[model samples]
Target: MKDHLTVVKHPLVQHKLTMMRKHDTTTGEFRRLLREISQLLAYEVTGELPMTTRRITTPMEEMDAPVLAGRKLALVSILRAGNGLLDGMLELIPSARVGFVGLYRDEETLRPVQYYFKVPTELGERLVITVDPMLATGNSSVAAIDLLKEAGARNLRFLCLLAAPEGVARMKEAHPDVPIVTAALDERLNEKGYIVPGLGDAGDRMYGTK
Candidate 1:
């Protein structure tokens, strides 16, 4: 909706995204592409991150190198699907603090309820990044963000592999300040509230389950 949602359209990300959209893409292929896409998205997500120049010792000479400045990063996974993206992101920011939240929707109520919540101690001092692979109805994402907010996380951003217009709108309406970085925004969700042409259940494909 607003400038909060940044749809990463880099060629590398787009090419890998294309592979994931193909039905014939194998599990291994899908996993690999997801990792690559995650890396590309990570670059975009870290765009605004503050960096300070520091002297580096190279064989040739000493030169100033950009190092992370400002508050450290905290990555919160919206388990268990969000774990997939966490891997690649962590490879980049290995020292970042990690957190987890578990949310499952009730079939009858179709509302999200949290089952588990754990965050770092100094959440207010860290830049929060909450990740989930799919943004279908936005119920779980919104609920997860609410949980983070309650837990005292101030600066927040969302990282997702796929998103739908409906879910995007819902999230923008709820938490416009917490920007979202995603690989692709699909057409729309179907009647069943699943992202259309979306890579099917991310959890399933990732863990080899149903």
Candidate 2:
């Protein structure tokens, strides 16, 4: 992943994202697409994970097999919408440690207010990936990363399904050391801080809520 951002333009990812962005995509379908697309994005985000070879016997003979190195990496979901991405990622990395940081955007101020935070131990020794479906204003995402760092996470990456330029810039300015991976970088944000042409509120769409 680049130091700033990596947009996954894989054909399948783009296709699924389009399906997800459709206004009339059903709730169940939206969720399934998010899960599928998230796994694809996970493939990109975790591509450079530290690898070590271990001697293992195959059906034919012994061989050195490449495997992930160091402690099991942590997956920190940025609440509500983030859980949508988290579920799919867990299917791909079942052994990964999971954590959650609950934050909500203050409608008027567009600032993030944290209500809960819990993360894995030995955070500094493990790679941490924070997942959220949208990076709009980036207030909540940045606040979540701040909390993770305060908890001792060093190696960190931010993953999202869609990003607005404003949110990407915000994250780059606030956490330059952390890399960002997203399926798409949308045009811009609307006045309400929503990503323009974004697929509406992910949580609401996934849950059939307003």
Candidate 3:
């Protein structure tokens, strides 16, 4: 509910998400919707990136063109569903360095365990944006951000396709400095910790996997 967490309510983002939520949508359709949402979300995520002007040839005389001013950003994805969102965000900021954090919750303790992680160097200098499709329990997302924090990421943010109130609250309490941009924050988490009225399992929908 903080302004720091920008919940996008734009019509295009809302419409696309509605289509994606439909059970009749095909895997390709789901993938396309995710990509579209990611691209649109990228605009907000990268709104404050530093920019400077540079001389460029415009098929005529030289002209000044704006370009990114400082260190390239790090776009870390909480895999494997995060990769679905990653593809679209990358299209908007192709220069951003990529990273991945793999986390899966154990059914018994319901704790997140990391399976894989690899990030670019100099995280402290560049802005870091960690992304995932669903912020259900926030355990995995927080764990992944912990890793990024350990890697020297001071200025960080998160991008998710959807979120549950419990998940958002958890993230806010744990890492208040890290801002979040999401398409929608649903009602609440169901018994199994899934966002109610959510877009089901984003991993399954995006990749057509069960």
Candidate 4:
């Protein structure tokens, strides 16, 4: 979390990402790959979680066992496409507290509009990780973080499958303290605010919709 951004270069994550980027990948296959890649990414993102040791008796003898410190970590999905990544992360961290923030971009302005918001209590006492598949314009990501902060979350991390340079910069300017973890940072965002070389709309691809 020291660095502003961390790109997971693990081989498995890269291979699965390539399959997802292919236009020919079917909806079912895309969803499967995303779930697989998401678990791998989750491993990297949770590396810094605080740990404490508790004395426990094993079959052999009593010993100190390390466990997650304090309250369970909070996982907030940025709604819709974010659920794709959220689902997989949950499989890996089943005990994590879950929440959701619903927001959509205005086609003309590309700004995020919030429609729903919910999260775990005592956000300031636990690590909060926000999951969203793509960070394109950063408008929605920043806005989501803004809302989370207002809710009292102090420790925060942003996780995504892909990121555009413009979006990364915007997030840094808006919330430099929140680190970003992504599978890959693509070349750039197109005029329409989509990441170039990124797999098409994650939500649409997962659902097999236009």
lDDT of 4 by residue, 1-210 (tens): 899999999999999999999999999999999999999999999998999999999999999999889999999999899999999999999999999999998989999999999999999998999999999999999999999999999999999999999999999999999999999999999888999999989999999988
Candidate 3: tens digits of C-alpha lDDT, residues 1-210: 236579999999999999988889999999999999999998888888889999999878899999998799999999899999899988988888999998987767667999999999999999999999898899998899899999999989999989888889889888998998999989998888888899788998888888
TM-score, every prediction: 0.93, 0.98, 0.95, 0.99
- 78 Cα displacement, candidate 2 (Å): 0.6
> What TM-score does candidate 2 reach?
0.98
C-alpha RMSD of each candidate structure in angstroms:
1.8, 0.8, 1.7, 0.7
Per-model CA lDDT versus the true structure: 0.87, 0.94, 0.90, 0.96
Candidate 1 residue pairs in clash (backbone atoms < 3 Å): none
The C-alpha stretches of model 1 lying farther than 4 A from their native spots are none
User: Considering only N, C-alpha and C atoms within 3 Å, which residue pairs clash in candidate 2?
Assistant: none
lDDT of 2 by residue, 28-142 (tens): 9999999999999999999999999999999999999999899999999998999999999999999999999999889999999889898999999999999999999989989
Model with the higher lDDT, candidate 1 or 3: 3
**Residue 8 error for model 3, in Å?**
0.9
Ranking by lDDT: 4, 2, 3, 1
- What's model 4's overall lDDT? 0.96
lDDT of 1 by residue, 1-210 (tens): 247889998888888888888877888878887777877887877778878999999999999999998777999999998888888888888998999999987766668888899888888888899999899899999999998898888889999989999899989999988899998999998877779989888888877777
Number of clashes in every candidate structure? 0, 0, 0, 0
Distance from true location, Cα of 155 in model 3, Å? 1.2
